[model samples]
Target: MLYWLIKHVLLGPVLRIFFRPEIEGKENIPAEGGVLLASNHLAVSDSFFLPLMVPRRVTFPAKIEYFTEPGIKGRLKKAFFTGVGQIPIDRSGASAAQAALDTGVRLLREGNLMGIYPEGTRSPDGRLYRGKTGIARIALQAGVPVVPIAMFGTDKANPIGSKMWRPTKIRIKVGEPLDFSRYSGLDGDRFIERSITDEIMYALMELSGQEYVDMYAAKAKEQAQPLPDRLPESRAS
Candidate 1:
């Protein structure tokens, strides 16, 4: 279908030829069954490149805004995400977070590879951030293993404000799947969830060699805002 055509024929070929993305530990991904690909979010291209490299169709819960914007560009974006099987979740309201996790659990139970960023958002400074527990909740709910993946050089190719991708070498490292089968049926336990999330973040830190920031990426970005304005004072101007 459209996913196959885009990944294999249209976009895949172009990316392979130019970026020449490399992957390590490909064998770590389970050959079949419901599993979680827990990865560190480095850049927007992390989504594109990971799916292209993996054999299976990886589905991500895209923010509802991506599918609801106005104008022709918005229409195309919606169509592309829908055609490729992305699930749109409204990332607003108190119930939105649970709804997204519910969708992921259902997908995993259906034996689909669900791509999740445990950190919740892209790393603002390329350092691994403390992971949110939604990933752990989904994994425990679905009774699946969590595979840690590290993406390298994507931030350079698709930096924060770049509209176009540059030719930068890309590399992916997949770590062994972390099994929390012993914690089965304990999905809602906050302590267990935090423990599981921290373990996943540690694996990503080891794989990516990025500094592990104790704070969440979103908070770090917020704090980073004031530094820019303070830079002038530090420079004595």
Candidate 2:
């Protein structure tokens, strides 16, 4: 109810006017079934824009903190994310990541599209990064096609911590649905996951026209920061 209300009544109509997203190959998305939307995380708006353009409702697992924080800000945060149909997942560590994938798989099993950032977190830099294999695991577990979606230019609209929205032409390109059934059944080989990750990235590379980095997106993002500890999940050592 809340999701539809926002999608139709409130926010949707407004966003449709200003942040006009030029979507390409939208037909690549399955008509009515579960699918894994593996997309590059460029900006916060990336989440809403793609889902808004799609006919089917896509669900992404947001960080749990978005819902559990206390106070007025927390309440607003919860309302905003829930209205967009984001499920909360804990990103504490590996176990939590598995749990997140588990939740995503559950959604897919129910014939719902599950959107994920294989890079695990937002890429501070615009460069493409390596994706974790959790997406592959879900693809195997749920028997759903993985659709690689790439987004560009939204980063300029909302860069890092700008309060107001900027006018930037957003481009979203969808790739053909990729089937991994043959490799999905492989016995716990790391190569299988790596291959799946490469397939998705290759599609994104073609769509976004960005140089592909064999490293993790989160790591590329971390390197841009001056923090004492800048390691990211699934970093290529």
Q: Among these predicted structures, which one has the highest TM-score? A: 1
How does residue 233 of candidate 2 score in lDDT?
Answer: 78
Ten contiguous residues with the weakest lDDT in model 1: 228-237
What is the per-residue lDDT of model 1 for residues 1-237, given as tens digits with 9 covering 90 to 100? 989988889888999998999899989999899989998898889989999998888998888988998999999999888766687998887799888988999999999998989888999988889999999999999999999999999999999988999999999999999999999999999999999999999999998999998998889988878554444445554
Over the stretch 15-48, how does candidate 2's per-residue lDDT look in tens digits?
8788787888899999888899999888888888
Q: What are the TM-scores, per candidate, against the unseen true structure? A: 0.93, 0.91
| Clash count list over all predictions | 0, 0
Which residue runs of candidate 1 sit more than 4 Å off their true CA positions?
A: 227-237
Q: Say which candidate scores most in lDDT.
A: 1
Alpha-carbon shift of residue 142 in model 1 (angstroms): 0.5
Instruction: Give stretches of model 2 more than 4 Å off.
Output: 227-237
